[model samples]
Target: MDRTTHTPTTDQSRPLPHVVVVGGGIAGLAAAARLRGVVGGGARARVTVLEASPRFGGKLMSGEVGGVGVDLGAESVLARRPEAITLAQAVGLADALQPPTTAKASIWTRGALRPMPTGHLMGVPGDLDALAASGVVSPEGLARAAEDATLPRTEVGADVAVGEYVAARLGREIVDRLVEPLLGGVYAGHADAISLAAAVPQLLAIAQRERSVIEGVHAALATAAQNPNPAPVFTGIDGGIGRLPGAVADACRAAGAELRTDTPVASLRRTAESWTVTTEGGEELAADAVVLAVPATVAARLLAELAPGAAAELGGIEYAGMALVTLAYHRAELGPLPGSGFLAPPVDGRAIKASTFSSNKWGWLDKAAPESFVLRTSLGRQAEEAVLDLDDAELVARSRADLREAAGITATPYATAVTRWHAGLPQYPVGHPERVARVESALAALPGLALCGAAYHGVGIPACIADGWRAATAVTAGEVSPDLVSGTK
Candidate 1:
């Protein structure tokens, strides 16, 4: 069926199924889009997305600085994962998708900016020689990392923290210098606590197979190298990844999905006939099915009365806040910086967790503002809320100070912007996968219900889109199925 023109089914005896998506973020929008694709218009079901915020695109936001378009939140989506890419194409972004101009990055460790080492999976170097050449890991650290080959098999029983497991095999240096920074860049959480099973399951699988992680990494890398077809690891729209949410929302609307912003869902009541979502404005919308795509805390509150067990599971999930200090300097003052950006290991005690040289990373951003150079530095991580609490000027000052130390970038930016995300990124501590499973299991009792977000599954664009698809499948299939929400891709 042409979803854009889909009308209600011919059976007048049955009214159209209504799915209320209680969030307008990428996950919610993706869910709406999926529902439309599956049942166009109301042929199968009609979707209504209610967002508490005034705008959509929860974390994937596009903004302007120095008269140039740039991403204020997430910069890119994993193109290798078909969900995000496929959704982008479905929403008419096939031609708009663009890969990064440069993948080269740096790791700021041991008081210097070193080239991000190659032959690695999520910063766990498969080749020690390449790792040593990058100088990211110290000589002593390299020796300890090399010990992984000779070390006895380390048991990764059910699940273990990524840092704890890797450090036990390699040394703490590799975990602190390499893995921590990489994981931090992704989750804004500490590697020592982040779950290997939930965050990097591939690494966990490798740990389980090979007696040594290094050997496992080598085999994985070798297999990847032999593959005839490989996809870009990441992708973004020409304007910025921020354009994705707007485009997705447009597509959902075009498909006859109602997307309402600033419409907060106050409570959800389950009747024998249907699920009734009450808005804070006192408007009650009856939904044949519902997808809880909001934040954990919000979802917990909404599910408190309906599915208390699922709400209890959600209550255990926590979030981390951070700030993005975006700076735009005159091209005359600064030529393209060395690499795309650098990840600052928390061990370095730096104010900024990571930095992205926007102009150098994306061809479109570079071309969009030929006269200006753009870059952004992120600060704060899980339990590091004090840094993000600093005033905007102080945050900018701190970011500049770090840039000066790492990249020798001292020229004051002509334009600057600070974007703060309070309780933004969800932390995936050990046993998070089990927790997600329990949540899903509990939701199985509530018919015509599903939950999805960065909280349960992986926290990325592609993962969120996949979660949305899972929720759509569950609710559309006419059951409360949390089992479908498992797996990232």
Candidate 2:
């Protein structure tokens, strides 16, 4: 059940299927859109998306901050992944695709801000000299990290924690100051708990091949440098990355799909030749296939009766809550912004984990607010939910204080906005690969039933889109046995 190894087989002769996608997030929308494309015209598959919330997009949201349009949720997608970019282009967002203006980023640690070390992958330094020159790691820490080459190879059985593995090879300073913040920004989970095999599978594979972690990183970086047409690492829509979901939803609807918001799914049951998906309002919809694309907790609740094993594994997955405090100030108040903003590692004892200079990073935002300096700071992480308890005003104040301490800016913001995401990010802990395998295996028994989202494959937009596409392909290909559809398996 290796997620990387399994591939879905397709059958074009299968009878037209009816797909019911639960949850209206990017994953669900992507599934519906792809399903339509696969089935084509002439009363193929009838696709329906049911969203519990009033809005279709899950974390992709847009709002006005200080009279300027801005993203309140996810703002960018990694351009390296073709899924998101391909989907965007397919949905007519090709003209809107924009790359960040700045690539520089700094790390705030050990009492000062310093440029992030070059030749590193997720904080694992490929060039030791570059890391030492950056001054992010102390002399003692640098010396300890240099010893990695001489030390015996550490055995990584099955899976290992990202921090534990890196710290063992390098030093604790690298884990605390470098890896922690970068990894936190994505998973919102502590490095000591995140699974290296699941979070960074490439690194895990390299670790298994090379004796030295440094050598492994160096080899990977070298390979990346050889790419002829290297694309930008990240990209965003002209308006905002939040616009992606709406565009995808539109495409889904255009393909003859019915989308319903404020309709939470209450239960799921299997019947002869079809599956019954009951809504919270007591309405039932029968479908040939069902895709559970909601949060892991919600999916678990709905699948408990149909797939108890998958439900148990889904229930075990944890999530992290986070809040973003976006503040806008006059350009005159903050003369110039440095880098794209800085990441404050937890070891720095700062309330804010990271800050992105929206005005400096994206040319569109700068042009939209020529007189304003807009930036957003993120707070809270896995097991660090105390900041979420504070009121929006208090959170803004704390964010301002942290910004001032980090970048000597004291001017009061002309406008401020706070967006709270409760249990937004999924945590991938050690042995997550095995957990995913178990979940997939259990679902395999219940044909026409699939799951996809940040909780599975990956948390990035591209990964989610790929997950959705795969699920749609699997369900529509008549891969599900008729016996399973009739609850006989």
Candidate 3:
């Protein structure tokens, strides 16, 4: 049976150019969707999405626990970015769009759950008063932070690690207690290893021109503060972000694109006029253009024979793995919890990195199960994979222990789930920008070829979507130009 859905009517007499997208992840789906949209609803080209896995969505996935559906992967997207939300709306999820609750988060630092400080950029506090009041750092650490304004001009040559630069400016205490947890939440990598330029470009740009990071943060945030009507920080689907990939795939199918799963491309061979994509099962598909929307390693292996330069660069990209442990408890037993959740700083020597009150953060979850409460804890980090190796029972026990200590929740969960993602998040190391540029340079000569994923730009949903559109545009230009994809401009 054909898995494709809602096939739109197309002229059968005309032979449309074929465009093969390698990957069934969100990025690849976005690419196929954009390609179909640009090709006059598949009238100009036949778009086919091929995936190795049986399922789509990549890290965006949903699972059920205790009679309640929960997000087993990413929960939300940056609402300020137009790409994700726009794509969601474009794919008929406009009515399902929902913002998270207004409840603030806390930082588990200095041996307790402290209020998360405002007036900061990625945990680098701009307002010393706010940082002090929040107690994310000690008095001595706060004193050291003040020295950034008086310190000599620090040079961030080309690029640097976020931890290195921030520690040099403020203090290691801030990096360990504050910055690490925040960056871990996003990148799942160590602050000392993650790239400042690639991970936090705005912070890098500020540190480049300004002498004091503090002053630069103020100047950077001033633009947003000046705006009276600021957008919500994030948005989620009524179900979960996992629904996005299916919706996009449905839209692509409706646009007359072929969607396939469990078929991996083994090699990419370039023909004189087109490309030949050989699958693992030895079946072949010809395409005028190809978008390599898979992870770096898989992409490297597939492109080794065709584009060795790109393969070489992509092979070096590292990825971080993590496990999400979701536990469900009776609402009466779990008791009331403050805030959405708290980020656990590694410096505190905690077993779990962070925990989210899924029932509190997403009002949908609360409304879905008024009598049940659900939450999740993240384990493992870049260069710290031992925790991910733990058994599900052990993982759940550690998470429960942490909850008992921090939030004082001693209730046993009625249901539990453990989702492990090995090599899940791509790490952006120092010189990541240069590495990505080199990859682009290598692919420039290879016409009708494109790359898009968390490896190139960002790990967020919006960035991946933007890169997907960029890949589509790169293959065929002026077709899907939009404000969200202006980065490629």
Candidate 4:
């Protein structure tokens, strides 16, 4: 089924090798745009994107709510990830980027929202005095955390669950009360499943090198403090996260990459020098190289026969479902919200795992007269499947109850938008590094094929762009380097 090369009849001039990018999500689009620019210039290489959905963006979706743009999926990029920033610059949307209005965050505990202690990075504290003064943890809990400097260190491979590692280094209380809930909100995953190396490697690096989580954090913070320039916390676009995908798509079109929507890929098979990609409508596409940029599960099905080993490894990767319920209400309608956001411990039997004061947290978005508030409540986590079983009405009701009890918000929201992401967030399970190594090793055996997505490395928007661009770069270069693609493994 694999053809050495493909030259469509409509195409003029010498038809060069083609690069077919599967899935129209950001990863796919990024790869297509990059490859078209670098390899065929769109006209020569014949880059065609085969998306399985009517629209692009995958998880980066935005829509108007009460005449305001609301992002329904993957939200902001941190300034720390420079790859996304560079991609934005390339797409001509660098000017649209903006930092989070405020870096302030909080935790929902004891039916109240309290500010996260300063100098704390993902539950690892650099300032012990601040941790003690923040009132987030008990005195005994604070003492236990400080004692991490004296506790014996555990040496293990890079593949380990974040929850287990954090608990071992710090304590179970911190893992459950702070790290699990706070970081867990990012993936909507169980701490026990998310890999420490793949998900939060910085922490692992701290433990491995410094021998103490606190000492490592302090050293890192000192390095940051010494830097000539330091970046902010949360990074986003001025308009919204939606601007990123839109800008990327525009750049792809300008680069001569053809984008087709309302199309779904049926299957794929590898040829001697190219791949034959079939669409749901029975049309077949030919390409010299292909990039599978969708979810791991989708990639597994597409590469089942052509790359069975990689497909099997990809299929083994797990994902968690997520639902975002955005509720807007007048400031006076709710008594008062004291924190930017709240992360619920797993012990809390409530359906909501986290909630953010969207409008207040971002100064520019707080345009409502009299200070109207927008709250984004999240439901479902890796270990909490029952939350998703609740019907929409029941889900909203439960969320409202949690907010009312936690933040004293009794007023009904004027606008409510609920989005459910099934198998939305990728979970970097233990031994993920080995699994990725296996998949990438298998992919390397194929000279031109590559796979890119949040399923591999960091799930942030920037990481996906980095993976996509790298894959495209390899195709254009006609050869791929292991270090470039196999970053960790």
Best by lDDT: 3
Cα lDDT tens digits, model 3, 1-489, are 223333334555645567889998888888887777732233345688999999999999998999999999999999988888878988999999999999889987667899999998999888899999998889999999999989987987778999999999999999999899999999899999988888888888888899999988987888788888998889998888888998988888777889889998888888788988888888888788899999999999987877788899999999999999999999998778998999999988999999999999999989999999999999998889888888999999999999999999999999999999999999999988898899899889888999999888889988898888888878875465445464621
Encode model 4's per-residue lDDT on 1-489: one tens digit a residue.
332233353455646567888877777877876665532233335577767777888888887655567677766876676666766777787777777666467777645576787776677677878877767777778778877878877786756788888777767777777877877877778778777787778777876777778877888878878777778767777656777777777777766666777777789777787677887888887777888888999889988887899999999888888788888776776776665777777665666888887776665566533456777888887756666777778788889998888777889887787888888888888888788889998988777788888888678776787688777876656443342233431
- Which stretches in model 2 have alpha-carbon errors above 4 Å? 1-15, 38-44, 478-489
lDDT of each: 0.86, 0.86, 0.87, 0.74
Q: Which stretches of candidate 3 lie over 4 Å from their true place?
A: 1-15, 38-44
Quote model 3's TM-score.
0.95
C-alpha lDDT (0 to 100) for residue 343 of candidate 1: 93
Please give the lDDT score for candidate 4: 0.74
Model 1, residue 119: C-alpha shift (Å): 0.8
Could you give candidate 2's per-residue lDDT for residues 1-489 as a string of tens digits?
101111122555565577899999998988887777722223336788999999988999989988989999999998887778878887889999999996588998887779989999899999999999999999999999999899888888778999999999998999999999999999988999999988988888877888899988998999999999999999999989989999989887776688889999899999867898988988888788999999999999998988888999999999999999999899887867788989999998999999999988989999888999889999999998878999999999999898888888889999999999999999999998799899999899878888988898899888888778778867876332221112100
Candidate 2: residue 222 Cα off by (Å): 1.2
- Worst 10-residue lDDT window, candidate 4: 480-489
Between candidates 3 and 4, the TM-score winner? 3
Better of 2 and 4 by lDDT: 2
**RMSD each, Å:** 3.3, 6.3, 2.5, 3.7
Clashes of each: 0, 0, 0, 2
**Poorly placed runs, candidate 4 (over 4 Å):** 1-16, 38-44, 331-336, 368-371, 478-489
